[model samples]
Target: MKRAALVPEFTVPSPERLPDMWPGREVELDGLKAYVRDTPAAAPGAEPAVYVHGLGGSSTNWTDLAGVLAGRLDGQAIDLPGFGYSDPARSYSLAAMASHIVRWVEHSGRGPVHLFGNSMGGAAVVVAAALRPDLVRSLTLISPAMPFLDPRRSLQGPIVPLLLLPNAAKLAARRMSSMEPEALASMVIESCYADPTRYPEQRRLEAIEEARRRHLVPWYAEAYVGSLRGLVSSFLRAYLPGEGSMWKMAARIKAPTLVIAGRQDRLVDIRTAPQVARLIPDSRLMMLEGVGHVAQMEVPRTVARAVFGMLDELQEDKAGRAATQQVATQVRDGVRQRAPRVRMAS
Candidate 1:
């Protein structure tokens, strides 16, 4: 059974958003440069929350959800290397991605943070949390791209074989260069959303603009294909019974976790949601209906509610533990006071 958490009493907060994606600046992480959008919390003294986007996604992917949770978390959504204006990295392996996250958190001096990841980012964070437990206080995974054997129905299935081709990135880049930004955006929307109409028209326009920028970048297709190859490698490791397995890494994660899966997600299978919950010792699971791979984008309010709910439960648990300790101390003190004179021969 999933570990139990207190039922929070609060209601889901109404979403707040800007006309466009939250503005951000580039930050240097050692030699790796990354772009991140910051969303300050509505309340003071809020804990830091770092968001990592999925393959092909940028920090903008978390814009809506980050705004919705701004009351509780000081959100920073990062654009991983080779995606979304971030400098390209030498490697696109899952381990490399996790290392980037680790380095960023360390560089920020923000250890023991609330870390959030989606799809490929989710798998990366799992490794990060496992690698350095002290760096993470909590984990929230949205439709994490866990390893799956049957890719026939998955969104990435058709492209699996393409990884074997020589100069795959160059080939893919050439093919993508021939397509318009609108077409690419439309393809992503159709592939990711359970209901295309739910996506805001303005956001659709933003996506197209983002796609146009991406097409102009030298590493756009390289990043996409390279990350895909890394993800598939991770999938292969999952089947092997060894220390390199992601399942093993996930099982080692010590932080309290929240796993959100979209029932209609075409990329990651919802059937694996239970497995994810089970593997992570202290975790809560939320399966959303009529939602696709990007639940945070499709239903920001609901995602925010679940996130806040987890925070509330953790807060209550802390309070309860403190109260219990206080009562125990008081009871011991009372006993000592009553029998103090006759105690201790020394």
Candidate 2:
């Protein structure tokens, strides 16, 4: 049986911005708003990194990681359609989200980019990279929601969608709203972190306050349902083996890959990490002990190091390959030039 806590032990912080910390370009399209930040490439040939967030999450979830990664490489993070400040769309699916990312990449004119995602967002990166290998130079997945047979162990499978059900979701929202801001904040931390005590009280309160405000919107139920439906459907399709599922496509991924998982995650079990590492041929896995579902949020520095480390490796690999090709071409040209001289001497 799964363990359930009646009350959270820590205090939640109030929701307030620290000012210009998460400032970025805001693009509005089809009623959705995408918050994008661009960090120029550190080196002429360095590829930019693009980040996508998971379900019920906003780009803010990646604020810390983005700031750290931006210093090392060109980076960007966006709120997927219908989540965060982004407006709702008619449909939500991994493929649909991947398509949106492709457009974003093309519009940014960043050339090829390194991709990173958490949970559902991680799955989206995988699908996007598979669809357009030329546009993606490498991939870093933090607790990617791949195919899993056990529904009880996967948050994306059933529990999330159940919470999104019209009446049930509204009831849940109401219940959460009724709690004190501090209590609500504590609940959010409990759900988000394996060790909620590690998070600052202010951050937790801010998250709870945001949830409280969102609950007041009349169409919040509709948005919740749409988002959950898309996630559950995608989760199903990605898990079925021999179904041309996303897991099957993982083998086709040629980009250097890095998958990070939190051993203490209650939402998506850590057992999925090794399988993911095995499927992607050129991939490595980094499991963090005493962490939860949102490792990026829970331990930003560690996540940043693992993710940027992979980006560095990819850059080095590309440089090495380019040099090898250049040398091979020169050697071939020299052999051709000497062929006629050798024939005449003979």
Kindly report which residue stretches of model 2 are placed more than 4 angstroms away from their true locations once superposed: 1-20, 30-32, 38-46, 154-176, 179-181, 216-218, 238-244, 342-346
Each model's lDDT comes to 0.88, 0.71
For each candidate, how many residue pairs have backbone atoms clashing (under 3 Å)? 0, 9
- lDDT (Cα, tens digit) per residue for candidate 1, span 82-121: 9998999999999999999998898888677899999999
Which residue pairs overlap in candidate 1's backbone? none
Reference-based lDDT, residue 230, model 2: 63
Top candidate by lDDT: 1
Per-residue alpha-carbon lDDT of candidate 2 for residues 1-346, written as tens digits (9 for 90 to 100): 0111111212112225432336567886444666675544445644578889886676777766666565565778887776666666566767788888887888778858888889878887888888889988778888887766576775444556465455875665666557776675566578768898888655666677657656665555555566566656765777565645887778788888888889988767688877888888888788888999888889877776666566556567789999999999999999988876435555
What's the residue-level lDDT of 279 in candidate 2?
Answer: 84
Q: Which stretches of candidate 1 lie over 4 Å from their true place?
A: 1-10, 16-19, 342-346
Candidate 2 global Cα RMSD: 7.3
